[model samples]
Target: MESLLELKDVSIDFQSKRKSFNIIKNINLKIDRKMKYGIVGESGSGKSLTSLAVMNLLSDNLSIGQGEIILRTDEEKVLNHLSKKEMRNVRGEDIAMIFQEPMTALDPLYTIEYQIIEVLRYHRKMSKKEMREKAIAMLTSVGISRPEKIMNDYPHQLSGGMRQRVMIAMALVTEPKLLIADEPTTALDVTIQAQILDLMNDLTDEHGTSILMITHDLGVILETCDRVAVMYAGQVVEESTVKNVFDNPQHPYTQGLLKSIKTLGDRSEKLYSIPGNVPTPDEYQELGCRFATRCPFAFEKCFNEEPPAFQVGSDQTSKCWLHDEEANPNE
Candidate 1:
């Protein structure tokens, strides 16, 4: 697959009192054309931050302190240095985003028709009738039964599933090369979630759009992704094919997470959960593994020295001492 978007050594930081503190450190990921790539981690683990940085949507108080977000179109376009006007042109045209919440993402003040057409308005020059017809066609394609009637309705007038479908319609209307879906199904019920996931997968193949699926639910990742990166405390601990990461997770964090997933056979038993919580900014330790404090496999090396990404397979790496050759060969 061709490289679509690449986040090289990307780091995001928070600025306060004329000083900057690292919030996301050394995060590297490559999303390929037509690939459904997932980033899975607990809330506040910086998964969302990394995706936001890719869209150049980071806030004033936050900045990319290092690395580049490159969009490999006909040639490499570094998104970090693009003017707001330039970035505006890129968004919805080259890369579109669907937020977790459809309610907030769709303005209450605007009708669904106004919003979907607005995307085309921003990216392309079209006659009023042309844009409206395209908007209706896109909505119908996303499975809205009454696309014409629903177009006149406000976001609040629709069901959650309908609103989300509208969001997808808006995102996919441009047939963007990349789609960044930040837990787009989180707010919906199980059936709706499955439908949305299926719709996205179908449309992605139809449009040949690569997707970035960000969610805390491992099940969601396993169900919808081809490749995945497991993140912990703002850093990717392991990255590989979804099958490899699911069946042969290398990082201690990744292992613990997979073990925590509830299975049908173990349904009657108490559900497993990783103990402790993701550390807050001030609580983050300066040395050693940031996850050491909560890690069940932590030892002196784990608490005293940071572990770098160790090559574990042809396409897999884990940031854990357990993968090191000398990490106690006896064990």
Candidate 2:
């Protein structure tokens, strides 16, 4: 498959008067055309930050320290190199993002029609009639029964699910090549979550848009993504197909996460959880594997050296010394 977006050795730096350091380092990911790629991890992992970097929407305190976020559509575009104005043009027309909370992302003062029309007004050259028609059609495509009525409603007037559908409609109205869905279903109920996920899959398929799905929910990744990247302590610990991740997890963190998922009809009152919180960016060591502090498989080498990504399978890569035969040779 042709590549859509590529993050090559991407590192994000957090700067302050007191200190400057990297929160996420040396991340490499290749998202293929029309491929649904997922980045899954707990809070403090660089899942959302990575997506933000791709969108050039990182805050004032943070900046891309190294590497490239290249978008390949009509031509090769180094997203980081583009100016603010250039990026504004690229955002809705080429790459759009569905944020975590539509409640917060959407403007409460503006009507749904006005907000949706604004995207088309800025990124597209359409008259009032065309914009209104397109916006309504988009809402309808996202499974809104009365898009015309919904269009006039305020974000607060609609339910969470409806607002999210509006967000999806706004995101897809321009027919962007890539959609960055940063935990889009987090704020909704279970039934609504499923509906939103299904709606996104169907709409993106119809529009031929690839998705970079960032979420802590492993089930969401399984449901929507073909490829998955397991992030821990601001780094990609494992990158593989969803099948390989479920069947044969390589990284210790990935293994631990899979074990953490609960199944139905459990007798024990106790729930499984990964021991220790993800180390804060300040606590991140200058040397050694970041997962070494919590990993059960950590050896002398894990604390003394940083492990490079080792090719564990034809399509899988793992960042752990245990996968390196030379690092811990068997007797």
Candidate 3:
């Protein structure tokens, strides 16, 4: 499969007056054309930051220290090196992102129609009438009822679900090649969350757009993605197909995550939880496995040396000393 986007050794750092530290480290990801890829991890695990880095929407304090974010389509371009103006051209036309909170993402001052129309105006050379017509059509396509009326209202006027649908419309209006959804279903009720996920799946399928679904919800990943990347402490600890992730998670962090998910018909008084919190960027280990601090199976080697990517299967790789045959020769 041809890759639509590739992140090679991508690292993001936050620079402060006192010191600087890396938030995302040596991340390598490949999203093939129309491949539904999911990045799952706990909050502050660089899930949203990774997506922001891809979109070049990181804050001014944050910078890409080393790496190339390559976008391959008609021609290959390194997105990280592109100038602000060039990146703007690539943003909506080639890549669009639906942020977590639609209320905050959408401008409160602008009407829904104006927001959607703005996208078309920037990406497509269309007249006012054409932009308005297309905006209405886009809203309708996202299953928004009374599209015309909704368009006239501001972001605050619509329900949470409706605002999210409008966000989806704005994102897909340009028919981008890649859609980065950073927790698109966050803050919605479970029923609404499912609806939003279904709508995204359907729209992306219709448009043949690949999705980089960034969320903490394993259920969402299982339901929506073809492939999964499990991130821990700003690094990809495991990468595999969705089925493999659910059925045979390898890395300790991945296994912990799976175990933490509650199953129906279980009557345990307490829910399963992973021990300890994700280390802050500054607290990340400099010379050892990052998860060693929390991993129950950690050994002296795990605490002293960083593990390389160990091929667990033909399609899966895990970064753990347990998977390193040299370290565990008998196993």
Candidate 4:
């Protein structure tokens, strides 16, 4: 299948007075039309930053150091170098984002009707009546009850789930070709989270909109994504089909993540967790593998040199020395 979006060797850096540091490094991702691609990792693992890079929404202090974020539709375009005006034109129309926290993403001062209509006003030349009808319909489609009443209500007037639905409606209001859902269910309760995920899945399926789902939750990735990328300390440690990742995790980070998930009838006294915290960008190793510090299977080679992505299967790869054929000849 042809790719809808591709991030090739994308890296983002944070600039400081004395020096600069990498935040996200060597990100390579491909999202095909109607494909649900999940990026899973711990907090501060650059999952959200990767999505922001795709959207060209990174902060002023943080900039793409080297790489191409290519958006392929009727024609291919590099998003990193686009002018502000050009980016604005593409943002809501071609690529829309549903932020992690709807409360902060949505303007509390504006009515839901106004907010939804605002998107149409910028992207389409619809009349007030037409925009209102479309907005209400969108709310209804997202499973919001009494759409008309919800439209008049402010962000605080609705519950967390309702607020999230409003954010989804605003994002999809333009019927964007690619949707970047940054932890869309993070703040919602379990029941509401499931409903929201189902609604997003159905809507994306209906619209044929590709989604880049950024979340730390393995369960959410398994439920919502067709392909999964496991990220640790900014870079992707493993990439494969969702089923393959769950069945045959390649990298140590990936293994740790899977092992941490609690399964039914497990007799363990405590939940499992990966030891050590994710290293900050500035703390990343300059020479050795960034994950080597916390990796259980790390050896002299892992600590002395970085490992390139080793092909594990036809469509699976891991950035770990364990998969290096030359280094592990006996295996």
Go through the candidates in order and give each one's C-alpha lDDT. Answer: 0.90, 0.93, 0.93, 0.92
Clash number for every model? 0, 0, 0, 0
Give the poorly placed runs of model 3, Cα more than 4 Å off.
none
The 10 consecutive residues of candidate 2 with the worst lDDT sum are: 322-331
> By descending lDDT, how would the candidates be arranged?
2, 3, 4, 1
Error of 3 at 171 (Å): 0.2
lDDT of 2 by residue, 208-320 (tens): 99999999999999999999999999999999999999999999899999988887876777777888999999899888999998988788888888999999999999999
Q: Give a tens-digit lDDT track for model 1, residues 198-289.
A: 99999999999999999999998988899999998889999999999998988888988888877876756676778899987656677889
Compose the digit string of candidate 4's lDDT tens values, residues 1-331.
6699999999899997888888888989889999999999999899998988888888988999999999988788899989999999999999999999999999988999999999999999999999999999999999998999999999998999999999999999999999999999999999999999999999999999999999999999989999999998899999999999999999999999999988999988998888899988889987878899888888778888888888999999999988776675346
State the displacement of the C-alpha of residue 192, model 1, in Å, after optimal TM-score superposition: 0.4
Cα-lDDT of candidate 2 = 0.93
- The TM-score measured for candidate 4 stands at 0.98
TM-score of 2: 0.98
Deviation in angstroms for 171 in model 1?
0.4
